[model samples]
Target chain A: MGLESIPVVTQSASDGLTGNAAAVLREIAARLESLAKEGQSGIIDLGAMPLSPADKAWLADKLGQGEVEINLELDGPSHVRETRYAGVWWLLHHNPQGAVTGEFIEITRIPELVLAHPADIISGSESLNFLIDDLC
Target chain B: MREQEGRLVASLAQQGISRRTFMKYCATLASMMALPPSAGIAMAEAMASSRRPSVIWLPFQECTGCTESITRSHSPTLEGLIFDAISLDYQETLMAAAGHQAEEALEKAIEDNKGKFVLIIDGSVATGLDGAYSCIAGRSNLELLKKVAPHAAAIVAMGSCAAYGGIPKANPNPTAAVSVSDIIKDKPIVNIPGCPPIPVVMTGVLAHFLTFGSLPELDKLGRPKAFYGETIHDRCYRRPFYDQGKFAKTFDDDGARNGWCLFELGCKGPITYNACATVKWNGGTSWPVESGHGCLGCSEPDFWDGGGFYKALSMPANPLKLAAGAAVAGAAAGVAISFANRAKKGAAKAAHETTTLADLEK
Candidate 1:
């Protein structure tokens, strides 16, 4: 009697581009090594990069969400959410009219948009001193 | 034998799992244990006719998560039925007997089934401060284990705690907790290690024992190699994405939402080995990875101390400046090794003598 191996099918392969996805994952792994070892952070500008909707969605689902989330509404509306990767942040800068201006993936402890610039820090110091004088 | 001779078969029939289904389960177990297909029939026959083996479960410095994982896995199903069929002589958590009565029952069962019963232990054995760290029935876990180990035919160390001291044996282990193997040196011990090892794994080991009258082949760490042979990454669904150079930079980014891969998100699937990918938790529903969470690598030894759960296995915050130099050096080494191999081959070829028909005849 002829016999063949009974294949145990756990799941059907529905999503293609798995090979491409794996290559990108390896690059990310290397980047993660760099991020952890050298305290260096780089931004991947989605606006600048050409990625299909499917590829983008695939990346988002895999990354998951991180512990930190920062929301800004000073100028118009800006959203910053950290991905499951501790230092990876998703930054969305909105225009004053509430239109999306830029989208970026920032790899850092804190996104640049939310950080207080040197000029802003000096202005904040002056404002605080003025407030203290007014209170006195 | 006891009245439990046909009890398991009868209960299985009542459960409506069918002989075919029961046989299928046995076959699956056999395959999982890397046994021959014919062994499945043997397992079915053995389980159907043999009386249930007596099991005495002892919990020590633990969280009872192992018990929960086993009982909660596919409850009201065949696995549960098989678990129920086992003659559990004494268990402090599930048994109604308590205090001196429970202790007496444990003693009586050990006496009644000496050299035959299976002693299943969850949690670590505490030896610190005169074993005052964890005491039950006014006896330290170490004391109880020492007393009961000799009478047992085999000892099943369930969960990381019993197998490798688990979290209790993490850095600065306060209780001086040690694994079952640390204490019971003479008895044959099978370690099932996980934060709370996969439930089916526990049942699989039991089935192997009940069928073969002995434990399955074990790896160096005393764990059944069938389940822990491959890393989670090797069997992960998103492994394709990892190979494709696609990663999600942010949680809500397009890459993540599309479920590219979580290697960048500090997934421990690579170095950590377990059956989570294939045997999904909560009855083949979904595991931590499927649910969009990085594997905590709960099955590995000293998982708690492996590093931050969110940190990638061997990554740095910044790129190494000497990476290019290292690559050049690695290439030189590779070239040198290849030249050496070629030289050896050439030398062997030069020394070779051609075989002639006359020489062969001689």
Candidate 2:
């Protein structure tokens, strides 16, 4: 007997804009301008806002995807993707169980979490030296 | 369990939690609390270097639902990590000690961290019959609270029962139960009120105390303004539907199936101040309103006595009897009454008075 395939349900894009999606877009634009002028980065926490699924979908549609997509495995899995706008990045952090813990829109050249820490770099260098000594 | 005597960062590292993960957790908490993004770094640094503050959890006349909610927090979760960072010296439900050993643990915790530990109370204080209604280890809850409250740095009333005398203090109030603040006037008390409060709210309060060495800014009800500043209605997703005047008249009606507002179904979201709509519950899962149920106003004082659960807020306890021809007129009257009530609620929000026991009666 053949197994039945489960149907996937997706939310339809709302006919009318709801909530503060427009306000958030304006804020993102302002932040992007600030980033260019003063090199100051900004982050908007989507999780904290009272945004609906339609609002989020509208946001994603308006801020079209860009080329850069990066994934990091830290405490859990995190995805960072640049928006169509060069400096704006969308980040989603999840737990080990794959539930989203935080969602953010970071307006910067690169997200701070993506950078390798100084302590980690030093430890990595020390470990490489220890490996070299053992071989010698 | 007692926290390891060392910097929190080192202890966290020992448990295999990386510094980056800890920082991210702090950032998430900061975001949730509406603190500036930069505050996350400061919170992370302060908490990482600071000693884990000792917490002593006391249960009075509760059902242990608050304890259950907090413990159900997922393993290695941000809230769970904050809970881990604390030295839970004595918690009757979670602690291994029992009877004499439990009493000894409570005594030792108070002795070792006198005037420094956080006292978390999960239930109401029964004052009737000279507090005979509830007793622990041969001592009345009232007596135990009096003995322990003075020695703590701050008290956190963890649920509606401890905050506003919850169900036990509803009509009749047989036990004459009173809130923690009603009994202990000298100490600073923060009330995290709910039927069973959102677990992250508990840990958020702890994180704030750990980061700033003081309680978070509180509302008139001694609740953290960060979590209770806005009414649930202000942040509810169905608010747009409410604005459009679309309401679910009955539970399984077409409006409800279409996900319209629950205002007519007796939702107390308009007056209830809580973070359930935004911060959510059970690890960012669906909250009560999200699951197609109206809010019970569990976070507010005297919620249990706030008329019937199914009666609309605009309606009187005993609804008016109207003729068949006057049904539309009655609907219009209800709408008018609702508008007037909304204006009154707006004024009340503007004033934000401290709810007293007398107010609970009203």
In the range B1-362, model 1's lDDT, one tens digit per residue, is 22333677557657665454465456555655656545666887788767788999999999999999887775337567567558998988889989999999999999999999999999999999878999998889999999999999999999999999999987668899999999989999999999889988898899988888989888888988878888999888878778887776655567776777777777889987888887677656679887777898888777765645665665642222323221132434434544654665667568895543223111
TM-scores of the models, in the order given? 0.63, 0.81
Deviating ranges (above 4 Å) for candidate 2:
A1-15, A18-26, A29-39, A48-67, A74-76, A84-87, A95-99, A119-136, B1-7, B11-16, B319-362
> lDDT, candidate 1, residue A48?
38
Q: Tens digit of lDDT per residue, candidate 2, span B285-361?
A: 67888778999899999887665465567754422332212112343544454465566566766899554322321
C-alpha RMSD of each candidate structure in angstroms = 26.0, 10.0
Number of the top TM-score candidate: 2
Judge candidate 1 at residue A46 and give its lDDT.
52
> Model 2's lDDT to the true fold?
0.82
Report the TM-score of candidate 1, chain B only. Answer: 0.84
A44-106 per-residue lDDT for model 1 (tens digits): 545333344566677777877888877766334567898888887776665344544455666
Model 2 docking grade: acceptable
